[model samples]
Target: MRLRGRKGIREDLEQQQDLVVLNPEAYKGKWRERFNNDYPIHVEFGMGKGRFISQMSVKNQQVNYIGFDMYDELVRRAAEKTRIAWNEAELGDPTTIQLALANIENIEDIFAPGEIERVYLNFSDPWPKKKHGRRRLTHPRFLEKYCRLLNTQGQIHFKTDSETLFEFSINSFADYGLQMTNISLNLHRDGINEEHVMTEYESKFMGKGMRIHRCEVLVGQDALQEYQKSRLDKY
Candidate 1:
């Protein structure tokens, strides 16, 4: 859910070079250098207003987090959230969090192969139209990109309120031959724990009595080879 543009959003985002990255592609494989440490890196795709990634960054101070969103307006809001968290922050160097603006289509271009440790897909756009299946984040095409971007131990954590999309993704991952584990049909049934961080969409859905589905897909070199050998474009 993208927000309507507010006045001065672009200017404010431009001024947030410390916390927001507009030219993210330039960093590419050099993200570790940007963070100035060897901490493992995790990224949240489509981070709406940055609730999940911001909290995760502070909670897991040992890991670096990058939140990517297509909207400058949302990026600005996420940066604002990070700033507030920085003030009240006790554990981590809030600098460990960097929000960026990027589209999912060219995501492979923004990072070099074997650069990311984990990728989070939280409440991503469903792109439910049959013709737009390629646009779904869980599509085999994007999964291929993530496979190249992640190290051998890299994994993707995904959550959604759309059962249709969730089932589609399950089939997609299975057909792609990528190993999936920790599948959850109703994630909050046990209630969110210290390790669980809710996104803006997830919080709203909870208020409306909606169920959240989640799953984890592991990335491996062997799986990458298998995915490259076959095609599931029909998905």
Candidate 2:
């Protein structure tokens, strides 16, 4: 799916404000206002093409979903997929879902502390080299950022196909003292596909007979309290 983008894709995407958010930072702490609802907000980092988040948003109208990516091309694809999904279901308004073009490195700048209810990392870049460990999305620094944005009962779900990356993430989460649950070494084999949403990359790996590893880490009250103490906390 990584190829040259179609011409004028950025312009087309920008015009779809209902699907692709603009100046996301402006609505940082007021995400619920942007959605025009009080529903909890959940986000997916590195949301390649929109399969998971779009479907989740359509299925779970009670929660607001946001997908973020650095590439304008990918964001365009995500918005198109969301529009198609909404249209297929005879839905006119897409107030529950939004796709944004932004890098996760400065995620904290886009959302205020305690504004997010859930954080999802699906098939994220492994950054395999030891020297690049900090660059991984599950790194402590990034985890801290997630914690800051997550509520006391916030959750972080991670999925990956690389055993090396999975192992690294397990250790990283443990070192951060985060509590993990419902871990799946082989998600599809565990008969849990019904509860999971497969991304485009995940489907490709599955088609190749690759196993997907998944885990969930909860941000305990203590962690959230600590984050709040250090931040200009927002709801």
Candidate 3:
């Protein structure tokens, strides 16, 4: 996870106003308005290099997508890839896809409650250590935040190559009272679904004879409330 310095990456991203939202906070609750459409907003957290989001936005034009990453260089590269895809598809409007540089811990600052319809966690950092368990994206704290940000019946799709992390995520989702489905232990070896958009990590791992794990979690009003109650009880 060592990031190489990219010269002028920030300046370049700032210039791509149509692709990267430099001031994401300005459109916090009004993300759909920025797209000029009421399409459901889907976000991919930790969208490294942006390969999956770019392809998904092109394939599903009806759903608006926002890719969030902590690094400006990675976000810039994602914007570049998305722009190329849009151009190849001959789509004049690039509003369907947007990139943002932000930390997942402060996600609430960038998105309002119930503003997002779906979340995608692709190959996220596992933070694999007993002391770092809380840092895992699927931890109860993060799941609670996701519940607040998602609309009723919102869904989260997570894919990973780490079996330990995958197991932990499954348990995390269950502990948070989120409903889970579409579980797969070996995504590619079992079968590649039509809706599956191969991520950069997925491709690389599969090439190395590694199996990918995938699952979908649904959050309802009751689930959110239950998670909140559990947090309150802990205090």
Candidate 4:
């Protein structure tokens, strides 16, 4: 399903002139100076509709946020929100957010080594077909790319309603030697954990009485090596 834009979303981004890089190669090894901040970096992949990333940026202004999504329309909306947040942040306003239009699979080309501090995979496509399992966002192939860009202490946060996908991701993390922390099979049953922020999808699902599955995976060089070695034939 496609989403339509409200008035001013596109125009807002144009007015702000925020740096929204579409080409992955253009950002290779150059993101640090772009935002003019050396603070820790966090990313949200498939930032559908921009709600989660924008809200997180407002909550944590110290961490620079770079959201990646392939959909041009969605990216534009996200860029608008980021620009708004950035402006507010500059004017002593809270929340600083940035965005990029790129695929998660090209993450290594999108950010340099040791550049990323954290990653959030919020309600990604489950890719239910067995034959298409490799395309799953949490598949080992993509995890390898994440590992390459994330710093040694970087961590990945994932939330989804698809039980199968969550199980698959859990196994992938274990296979790659990533330590899993704070896993919740039913996030809402116990109330939203303070650390568990709601994405657009997460909020919608919870409203419909569906439970959210969440987990965190620590990323490091060793995990990256194992992920790459295991996914060689698949990728």
TM-score for each prediction?
0.90, 0.91, 0.91, 0.82
Q: What is candidate 3's lDDT per residue for 141-218, written digit by digit as tens?
A: 999999999998588999999999999999999887777877999988866677878999988998899999999887
lDDT scores for all predictions? 0.87, 0.87, 0.89, 0.78
Instruction: Name the 10 consecutive residues with the lowest summed lDDT in model 2.
Output: 226-235
lDDT pick, better of 2 and 3: 3
Off by over 4 Å in 4: 1-16, 83-95, 221-235
Per-residue lDDT over 84-187 for candidate 4, one digit per residue giving the tens place of the 0 to 100 score: 76576664443346677777777777788888889999999999999999999999899888887888667899989999999999999999888877799998
Off by over 4 Å in 1: 91-93, 221-235
Q: List the residue pairs that clash in candidate 3.
A: none
Candidate scoring better on lDDT of 3 and 4: 3
